[model samples]
Target: MSIQTGDKIPAVTLKVMGEKGPQDITSEEIFAGKKVVLFAVPGAFTPGCTMTHLPGYIVNADKIKAKGVDTIACISVNDAFVMDAWGKSQNAEELLMLADGNGTFTEALDLVMDGSGFGLGNRSRRYAMIVEDGTVSHLALEPTGAVDVSAAEKILALL
Candidate 1:
């Protein structure tokens, strides 16, 4: 089953392009003691993702924080390098871009979507979840092929 509210995030290492170098960070490191806003997109730089999904989070990050969020993260199936570049391109310094390159975490959460038809291999569905102290508190997942439900503005409204 897909991870749901009250479920602890699966323990897995996610690659992040850190200032020093590539960092392998665990879900525990990210959500163990923090109230985190985590959102996933199908891929980096896709039309809907770039134009609305990620930018909504970037634009409303401070408001999300005011609701007691400790961190806001954007996740995708792309690698650290691409995620880093996308973050830079979007001017999203305040958000964390996590690279779930291998899809271990995505599969564990049952969120992986096959994109081979698009020649993109496997990717995460567009979705967002709120985690507190390692457990999910809320989830807003897009219906397959739908974009309106998982937008950052909707998530911010939840908070």
Candidate 2:
């Protein structure tokens, strides 16, 4: 079952690129006592994610923050290196690039989908959520291969 509104986020370790290397960060550390906007993509650098999904957040990050969001994070099932490179390429300095390496977090949320047909293996479905103090307040999931509901503007409107 995928996570839904009113569900507390599960405890899991995600990775992020640090100066030294990849560093582990816990879901608790991210959502605890904070209002956060988290968006997950199928993969890093894929056309929809690279061209539209990620950039929407990068551009509207400030507006989302202005609505009292403590952090705006982007998550993908890629390694930290690729997440870091993609963040830099998109100038996503204001957004947190989190790597769900090994699909731990995605699996925990019950949102993992098989993408082996496209040679991507297991990955996250496209979704976004507003988490308040570790619990989900709003969730937007794309039922198919479109970036309609999970856009930052939609999230901002929800906020």
Candidate 3:
């Protein structure tokens, strides 16, 4: 089943680009003892993800932080290298770019979507959530091919 409000985020290792190379970070390390805004995209660099979804979070990151969010992170099914390149291209210094490299974390949440028709293969569905110290306080899941509900503005409003 898809993750719901009040559910604890799954324990999974995700990758991130580090100075040395791709580094692994567990879900517990990311969410524990922190108020985090975690958002997921179907794939990195895809039209909707690049042009809109990710930008919303990048632009509103400060405001979200002001509401007591310790971190604002973006996760995609792509590898760490691609996610790092995309973050730099978008000037997303304020946001955390996490790679769910094999879609393991997405699968664990039951949020994986089949994107084979688009040649994207297994990917995450568009969604965002407020995770406080490892538990989800709010979850916004978008319907297929939509990005309205999961926008940062909506999450900010919730905060």
TM-score of 1: 0.97
Can you write out model 1's per-residue Cα lDDT over 1-159, one digit (the tens) per residue? 999988999999999998886789999999999999999999999988999888889999999999999999999999999999999999999999999999989999999899999999999988999999999999888887877767778888988
Each candidate's TM vs. the true structure? Answer: 0.97, 0.99, 0.99
Root-mean-square deviation of candidate 3: 0.6
Q: Give the lDDT of residue 58 in candidate 1.
A: 91
Residue pair clashes in candidate 3: none
lDDT, model 2, position 15? 96
| Candidate 2 segments whose C-alpha is farther than 4 A from its true place | none
lDDT of 3 by residue, 113-147 (tens): 99999888999999999999999999999999999
Report the CA-based lDDT of candidate 1 relative to the real structure. Answer: 0.92
Best-matching candidate per lDDT: 2
lDDT of 2 by residue, 1-159 (tens): 889999999999999999999999999999999999999999999999999899999989889999999999999999999999999999999999999989999999999989999999999999999999999999999986989899999999999
By lDDT: ranked, best first: 2, 3, 1
